[model samples]
Target chain A: MELFPEKYSQAIEKALERYYERYTAPENLYSPARYILSLGGKRIRPSLVLMAAESFGVPLEKATDAAIAIEVFHNFSLVHDDIMDRAPLRRGHETVHMKWNGNTAILSGDVMMIQAYELFESYPKDIFRDVVHTFNRVARLVCEGQQMDMDFEKEEYVPMEQYIRMIEMKTAVLLGGALAIGAIIGGASTTDVKKMYDFGRCIGLAYQLTDDYLDTFGCEKTFGKRIGGDILEAKKTFLYITAFDNTTDKGALRDAFSITDEEEKITAVRTLYRKAEADKAIEKSIAYYTDKALSCADSMPFPAHVRDTYRRLAVSLVERKV
Target chain B: MELFPEKYSQAIEKALERYYERYTAPENLYSPARYILSLGGKRIRPSLVLMAAESFGVPLEKATDAAIAIEVFHNFSLVHDDIMDRAPLRRGHETVHMKWNGNTAILSGDVMMIQAYELFESYPKDIFRDVVHTFNRVARLVCEGQQMDMDFEKEEYVPMEQYIRMIEMKTAVLLGGALAIGAIIGGASTTDVKKMYDFGRCIGLAYQLTDDYLDTFGCEKTFGKRIGGDILEAKKTFLYITAFDNTTDKGALRDAFSITDEEEKITAVRTLYRKAEADKAIEKSIAYYTDKALSCADSMPFPAHVRDTYRRLAVSLVERKV
Candidate 1:
């Protein structure tokens, strides 16, 4: 109760190490899985699983397997997505597909997925189907979301609503699913389970919006990444989508984006973004989703302090300068 | 009983049609899954599921979901495997990867794997874990097997035993798993389940051998293929591995395989194969595995006539001329 998700994060890390430590023979397949998991990131989704479980009074032991499953599944998606995106680094390390060849990455990623399912077998018998069905639904949507994103990439423009659905599926469902699975394992009532999912869905959307925001506005000191790189690539992120919606002059956006000079392009796009009110609109949207996420906690059956942690988590995630 | 696998196959085909007919939006993703399924595979694995369930008096209604799951999962692997091998066709139709594109195939194949799990959720609550667990172990091994196959392709030569194990993992495990799942659903005893798996393992080995044998020797009218394609590619099949093992001069085998002329290469390799007793060894090996497979049925808890059908199935599978 005192440390909330931070306390749960340590437990999840321990469980993940234990789950993957038993890696056996077939060095080719198991090594890539272990290697990818070893490249650490913020264990946010699994922490959500554990925090939700704890809030409902479920023991950490009961939630451990689901936490590990979410982490491993997330890594699995990263392995494949990195290949599709053709990115070279993840977590400041070589991505699985890049370290290994595409074939090895493909096969290892496939095995990691089954390994994710195998984790569910450790759950209590009564709730096994609930946990598995939730995972299946979420996993399927995640794939669909990825397909949508890839599909949209080739198109000149994507509708704002379609873009929202894309991120929700590709990025958000796993977050919501992790929460729902944790709550289910904690034996929460159906009402609370749905509420947690809605809460998670909003938080996930806000987190993605903030990520899109940070790509443009984040300091190199925090992210060590060049701002407006997405603009340079003509990525149709929230800002770009919102900018198109707000502005009548589409030619300016094209002109602003066509600048080859990095600093100039970023400055020009930012000016255009401000004129379209896209900057303010994106800020408002992040708040909107964050508030929607926090409001779900008000009706939650859990105590006020317990719900406050969720609000803190959402706010901290979406409003971060980083 | 008289209809045997053919009877079960009709039911499997019906279930598959119904399952896939629900295809909706996101044509990019679902179409490839449905397209591959529509390519009209023999439905052997699903039929095996239904037959195994029937042998233990498990009704078809109880088995259809698992049957469909196995078919979808098998197709999923085929889609991915084709991409890995860069094969252009499946069952004389454009492979999913070739028909659409690699990214679509990867994503669709991923969704198909999840769909396989989703189908398992439709199983009766009591047997869900058993069915799902069997599918996971088999699916994981299949990936491992595929990895081994790709790895072996890189090496100059592979040992006979390793080749056998690779196919057993890559090819046999799914058949074994499908049968095992059907038995579990039928409430068969643990001994009977193991027996079915063993029977399937042996049959899968023999079937693969028959495929290898036909690839080099069968009539094109029957095979609808170019004979000696494996020889041209120098694939590490059982025959090629055995040829390498039985020959004294590695140089001669290499020379025989290096011939660019199709007839010359096939004849040179066939002659070398005969001199090294590889042809005899392969025939003996196929019989050995087939007999080994049939022996598992000798002490089956089911009736003698029921056991006779399994023997007939194995014999027809291995002994087929076309």
Candidate 2:
């Protein structure tokens, strides 16, 4: 039932531990980076990087640096994003900006980014160029996505396509870029690299849509938190946008949004979402993206087992409650 | 009076203008970058990039992207640094964070850093890798230097050597890196590139020392701000550190630093600086570094005029009132 090779996950954890051991100086600037990294996530992106590289005939050892680089860059984005979001907690601990001050968080995050680029220097000339080129493009897109997310906060309505685009840029592209970097480092052909990127991107979209779905529809215990947290915040998530688009009782939807009591607001919005079939809409979109990911994986010039692994990864990422 | 070719500046301006025109989307993200760029600087770093490339026999046009990259990186640092420093003005305009908000400044600065790396993609694979390598090293050092500076603010005493190292990393290495990158792109020999980096580093040290000196001694009108601004802020500049190291009357120096009134603090600190002969100490350091820069320039593989132009640049940058 493991989604990826368990050994890949173990290797990644060891590599990250070795990598973070060097960040000891200037505690104010580097400690936050180390701290944030230590607060573990699923390590899915780095796992994808290793799996892609291995699938392309490169050993996990050869691609370890790129895997670490992707993970580091991802954490760098989180450190800064947490500051911008005014987020107090990450992974049940104080965020970087909360642990240190915002200024420390910003400076530390800046160094983390440079460190990510430095990780790519171990590669030879052509691979280094391609890897960094992909990094720069994806990094810029991530920033744009963050800006768009922030912009959406003040707006009354955000169209479904635009919201998807924002999430795609903000979240999906990095996943794609991570796979592409690993593939390039593994010496995959251009077509295979592109397909790997497409595969990761489709998986990322499906994963994010599932995240939205779980925020409302998931079991509180299984999801590890209360459901409808997004509704309480009146977030214009996929279900919110879809419901607004399809609901015949627009006034009731608006009134539901204006409800004063948090529990009542969550209940009313969930009811409206079900009535408009936004939950079904989100489920279909998730399936659509998941299918696209499988097709991309199937088209890759990998063995049948490798394709099956990717299929399982896509399924596990989207089908989970948490 | 022109230390560099007039056409180089003109070309740099045009190149920057053309480069910035493409940053139109997500007004909050790109506008701050554009706005920061629009507020003119001396263009010293970019000009160094072009001048170094040209000195190595590359055409000015060949180095425009690198030149712009260095400048953009500089501004990106400023945008983030201003946010950290809580400064309201940059080049007499509202700082990015002040004009918009801290979140915008942080995000915009993040994108700008990525954009700097993106500019390197146009080079051939080897050259691109080399240039980006130099950039990544310098960028990390710059962050470390900034952290050191912030660390110094809390300490009662900072060693003069550490202060110099901090400034060297924070301010000088970028200049050196910029020159080195240009030299690399222009096909300079490894020795020549090292010499170019040394020359720029020496000049940067001298220039920064002169900056510390002018903060207490220069005419307000010419310096474009009130003299002793560093003293007023109790900044541990070269003068402050050296004065504390050399001053016999430690109590009086401490008393001078603790003076509550603004003008009194300035006057007391300046008197202590002169008494310690820190003014003389700083001037000597500036002369020493400037001479070292000239020696470096003289040893480079260049024509007499090229060497002479570098000497003039060193003298002009370090010996200026502003």
The digit string of per-residue lDDT tens for model 2 on B125-162 reads 98898898889989999999999999999998999999
**Which run of 10 residues does model 1 chain B get worst, by summed lDDT?**
B1-10
Per-residue C-alpha lDDT of model 1 across residues B1-322, encoded as one tens digit per residue = 2325566777877887888776555779899998999887667788889989999998897899899999999999999999988989888999987889888888898889999999988777668988888888999899989988888888998988899999999988888898899999899888899999889888898888888888877777887778887888889988888888877798999998888888999989978877888777878888998998889878667899999988888888787765
- Which candidate comes out best when scored by TM-score? 2
Give the candidate number with the greatest DockQ: 2
- Deviating ranges (above 4 Å) for candidate 1: A1-6, B1-5
TM accuracy, model 2: 0.98
* TM-score of the second chain of model 2 compared to its true counterpart: 0.98
iRMSD (1 decimal) for each model: 0.8, 0.7
Q: Tell the DockQ for candidate 1.
A: 0.79
lDDT of 2 at A61: 88
Q: List the residue pairs that clash in candidate 1.
A: none
Query: Residue-wise lDDT of candidate 2 within A1-322, one digit each (tens)?
Result: 6667788888888888888786777878888888998898888888888988888888898888889888998999999999988888998899999988999999999999999999889999988988888888888999999999999999889999999999999999988988898899889888888998999899999988998999999998888777988887777899999999997788999999899988889998899999999999999999999999999988988789878888888889997877
Superposed by TM-score, candidate 1 places the C-alpha of residue A284 at a distance from the truth, in angstroms, of 1.1
